[model samples]
Target: MAARMKRRDFIRRTALVGAGLLILRDPKSAWSYQANNRLNIAAIGAGGQGGGLVNIFAGMGENIVALCDVDDRRAAETYKRFPNAKRYKDFRRMLDELANSIDAVTVATPDHTHAVASIAAMKLGKHVYCEKPLTWCIGEARAMRKAAIEHKVITQMGNQGTASDGLRQGVEIVRAGVLGQVREVHVWSNRPVWPQGVDRPKDTPPIPPDLDWDLWLGPAPYRPYHPAYLPFVWRGWCDFGTGALGDMGCHTLNLPVMALKLHRAIAEGKTVVVEAEHSGCNGESYPKWSIVRYHFPARAGMAPLTLVWYDGGKKPPQEVLSLIPGEVPGSGCLIVGEKGMLYAPGDYATRWQLLPADQFRDFRPPAPFLPRSPGHHREWVLACKGENITPMSNFVDYAAYLTEIVLLGNLAIRLGGRIEWDAATARVRGRPEAEPLVHRPYRKGWTL
Candidate 1:
């Protein structure tokens, strides 16, 4: 038999062909795939949320060409379901071996690893769908956005709520001035169900044979294997996860961010000041309970706004909670406007009501301006198939901006002072000490 071609050589030889096939194809005919025009897709972190994503895309008829996970135990079911698909513990090896074959990739890795996996795929001109809040730090978020644009790949963040008609309608109403000059917003979550605000565990257990402990660590600093940080409890840890704000902010803050056009405001040189008061952080993990406030200057012909985020059972003042009929939701968002408040009483912002029901009992929503999404994952897949469409949470258009804003709050929490953000330069003013946290150092062999 002839020798097999090396992965690097194959990638270099077919780079242009791959780019032309995926990126420079005829736009009008991109989405014209027949019922059986299945895409060859791969998934990273194929367990937990990743497993659900694998099933969803597979259910949509795409081919599961390959799957990668650091923990084989967690990904056993997915592996069993797609036995024909190749498997690997290291994503780098998978991408190397299948570089020219994958049409798209879905990333459900831990927060710290998101940028590395997604950027690697995008650099090869593959479309990507990544879980929120997009990246572990502000710098990675920016880099992901830039890579998506440079590679000209279709991209979407897995906020999921962006696909809801109710969420879209709420965004339209708020933008159409139905909320009447909103200036205050409150978003809360019942999170940190995992342990936080505590010191790191001292015991170092033997690494599980089913787990590649170093690969699982990825870009995070060296830490011994521990059950305390795995199997769905890493969100509260600062090193591996992004805490509650990073976990839930992408979903809870989606509507308000879109409604207020905050992204555009930030782009146009407006200052976004952020500060936080928490239950006290020990530096190893996020605080158990905390509230963060972001102040945005008036922009785009709108009033200045204050967005306060609460987590760990803390909530807005009772006066704000009184607007709801019953007890305030364990997690919700309330936008206080001059005329009335727009209350979305859940994490997804899927259902919302105008507060002071008596005053707006006869109110009517403005005509819809935003086009509705064909399911969120479907949106990304269709776009990847060359549809003349853009996913609602496309990295270039929305996700990156949203992630940047959400992660900035973490900076405030870490530095224990107000963050005067200069969006143009992506820096915190007068806080050189906080700059390292904005873009953290990675272990050797990792590059964004």
Candidate 2:
């Protein structure tokens, strides 16, 4: 076998090689078994969400040639599913060994590890589909965006709602002025169940034989293995996860960002200013509840809008919930506008209907359209073959959408005040004390 290649060097060559080779090929024909069309895929962080991604992609006829994860046991079952694929504990080693073969990579790791793994993969000229929130901090988010641009790799974030027909139509309706002048929007979810804001767990579990605890911790501080932090419950912790906002805000709260075209309003002071209020553990150790209010000057055609996010089993109110058909708001968003109201109390993939027909009969409910891509995983699988269409949750878009909500909310939770934000620069312009907390430091030997 040939000697392994460094990620940076591999990417530089791959970009020149892959672009020239892929540019002439038709994406529609790339999925077939033709010698020039087969795609080789690799997966990093094959545990909970990562394992699911592997399954989704493996079933899509792509060649899943590598699997990397810190835990052998959790990855064991996933590896068996792709028995022909090579497995490794570290993604860097996997990339080095499989550099020539891997055309794309899926990073389904924790929040803190997202940027590290994604940037490394993107640098190798491998198309990447990283999980939601993209990165733990705003700086990492920016870094990943830059790396993706520099490497010219197709990238997607795991905010699956973006691929949903309901969300697309909802956004279309909002853009078309059907929900005229959306002034106040409420986006929410049931999250932070991993027990944030509470003290660390008392019982430390011994590292399992099939697990590499140190590697799993990666850039996080040295903490003994605990059951509470593993097997899919890390969403609430500050160290490893990004709480509810980081967990679901990108999915649930994405509607307003897309519908209002908030990105275009940066020069007009029409930016996201989050007012975070009351954060602490619920029953278990979890910063389970946060009421974040996002104020935005309306995009040119609409009125100023205030977007509120509620998570951790918290409901907006009976009056607000009553606006929709069902008593339970569950895990979705409510858009309140001047002429009418629309309540979609669930994921965009599923049922999301406009409230009471009596409100606006002429207002035909928008068509619920499925995405052109096949789910989130396959979207990236297909994108690697020079197809420009990625999951609606592309990192450049999602990182901008998510980091603003999660990091700014975190600043409010930390500073205990509503800080005004300058979206152009992504900083709190008016407050001096709140400026330093904009980004957090990694433990060591790790960088955004």
Candidate 3:
């Protein structure tokens, strides 16, 4: 009888494939998870990066139950490909009607809408995979973390490198103290790849018929429809996006945060200091170039350190560059420690090298401690089915704080002054002017 019961359980675990999508059966369904029998996935902002994400999930054999986007022209291909999937222009309506059917949602919307779309899904207990720099502002990042935890939902921020073996290994190495007291970190990006330091266009362009301009401007203040903010260029605008620091900081800064426990300051009720200097700020968009500094308070036995971020063709000083050999990459991270420096020569912390080769020629890496991921999206998919694995970049554990640290730099940049961040209170010390930036007022129709 025991043997027979075991066989039944094994067969019950078999995945169900419907419409060519896999619905991996689970031992138990948790957190309002409905995908144990049939995984029905939804994509918000289904065009460009959003479209690409839907395609990847589809390739994983997950049913695309719904696709939501504000622009019809941009999402044309996605709608055509997933004709069977219900389509909508507003994500709120999509979540309202299809909440029961969708087991998970992928939020690839522009930076500003990330918090709203993701928080709404989490409130309904649907698993969420949101794009990087989790939200447009620091308040939203905190809210995203709260929603994920309160709902007991599975969450993965879309910094895919969080799953890579190299990144995980790097984190483990740093935690193992192989680098011997990492004191300073420098992360640089070649962003603003679209455009920055430009005034808002004066000409009012016709809102494309396929686009719902109101929906596109969701939480942001009202603005006439303009071509400049559409498709992919929203990263530079103050109202629409979070610029270079928000665009790439989440990816480039992941290693240092995880390894050095940069979140320790906040966790321990400490404040972080941040300041920025930039090239020509026009008050409409981010500067063409900027350098920002973050001072984290010492906590959890780790010494205090400062992280410097450079963007818009900015690179680190030559003295710092001299530590690594050969051609310096366009974007990379450097962690300076008492013993030696560790360099990650890419946007994602997918690869690393112990610098000054001769000094470290005999060094052997510490044994890996962090569990290696089974692909980024797969980790989320598995967790959605109540699998034992959790995504490394899950909101409650990692992404929220990482995003908070990243957005703080932008606050300093836009405010053009030093910010004494009171993490415990989530306020700028003696800077009432930053209230608008910290806690943004939503339009009447929107809510986070």
Candidate 4:
């Protein structure tokens, strides 16, 4: 027999055990700050990216209240993962049924559906985390931004790379003038592969038993069923997806855009557009070699700089590569400044490196002074629970990012000429003919 422990000692030991449990189970505890509460999360488009996000939130102890998708096969898979979660083929129905139960929503849908689904969530006061490219068109991006602000709901864009500690650290270093006054930026990507520049499908394949064909094409034009358009091959098409610029431009070009805060520097009421050459794409609606050019306003104590976006799978010229070693580091950025240059890998997750052999061969980055951020989904949930602003690719940032890149590529696609863009008015200045392309009218039953 052993003597009974005193009440105070027992209480202290119990608390210590509880603390250990919290430390091991809750990764958010590792951070100095977190929302005092958990978020009730719902996912729209329960497929690849969306599924990954759901798993992260669920692991963090958030209630997965809803799962939405158009494809039956996709929905069935999602249902199996979180059987208790309410499932719906249409997002609108999910929002209607679970509006009161959901505190936030993660939207991972095709470019065409991003705006509609996200706008709906925001209007209902749900914090929204939408996938990259933001929207199918520049107009939709603008509208989504407006809706998010109007509803006073927290919002994030699903550019996961932004959440990486490496990304933010890189941004701070560049902003600190470690790389000097920057001017030109070169961003490249390998994308734009699929059924581009080809004749419309002449054969109508039988609709699969598990797919809701009409629902998948919602908002986008109604077309006969085709296997080429299904599964993951939609990226290359015009009506359903945003081509390569829309697909990879947001992710590849994000660093330069945010590091410089080019969006914030641009005049709120003014728009700048420059004429550019376009080719490539093998006849797809978007060009394979479309070079996007934008004149960004001066900021961070530097003069105005021209930002050029390269797509159609083209590599930067040798002159640009000369500043860096080993062939421009493949998919990365070349930032040429007055004093020095900076080179960052194209993969947004990679860290930024100073260019040229002469600059600090032995120099080391400053001590890791920043707190290690949790994965993307957790950041949004934590941000939503408190008054803190979610820093990752939120709707506002992604809206500006997508509007510029998507419109740039869209201007390239319009065969008439290199149309001028007005960021302020959200229109194409010198070309009234291009205005129609700026805003796409949705098919019936879709509301913005």
lDDT of 4 by residue, 103-190 (tens): 7888888778888899998888777888878887777877887776576566777777777877767666666666777778887766
lDDT of 1 by residue, 174-264 (tens): 8788878988999999987888898899999898999998999998899888999997788889998999999999999988998887776
Native-referenced Cα lDDT, model 2: 0.68
Say which prediction, candidate 2 or candidate 4, comes out ahead on lDDT: 2
Q: What C-alpha RMSD separates each model from the true structure?
A: 5.9, 5.9, 6.5, 9.1
Candidate 2 lDDT over 325-412, as tens digits, reads 6467468778887767667767453346665667665667545332444676666655555444444566654444555555667666
> Could you give me the TM-score of model 4 versus the true structure?
0.85
> Where does candidate 3 stray beyond 4 Å?
1-36
Report the CA-based lDDT of candidate 3 relative to the real structure: 0.83
Q: After superposition, how far is residue 269 of candidate 3 from its true place, in Å?
A: 2.6
Task: Go through the candidates in order and give each one's C-alpha lDDT.
Answer: 0.84, 0.68, 0.83, 0.67
Candidate 4, residue 430: how far the Cα is off, in Å: 1.6
- Name the TM-score of candidate 3: 0.92
Looking at model 3, the pairs that clash are: none
Kindly report which residue stretches of model 4 are placed more than 4 angstroms away from their true locations once superposed.
1-37, 265-267, 280-284, 327-330, 362-372, 387-389, 397-403
Task: Please give the ranking of all candidate structures by lDDT, highest first, separated by commas.
Answer: 1, 3, 2, 4
How many backbone overlaps does candidate 3 show? 0
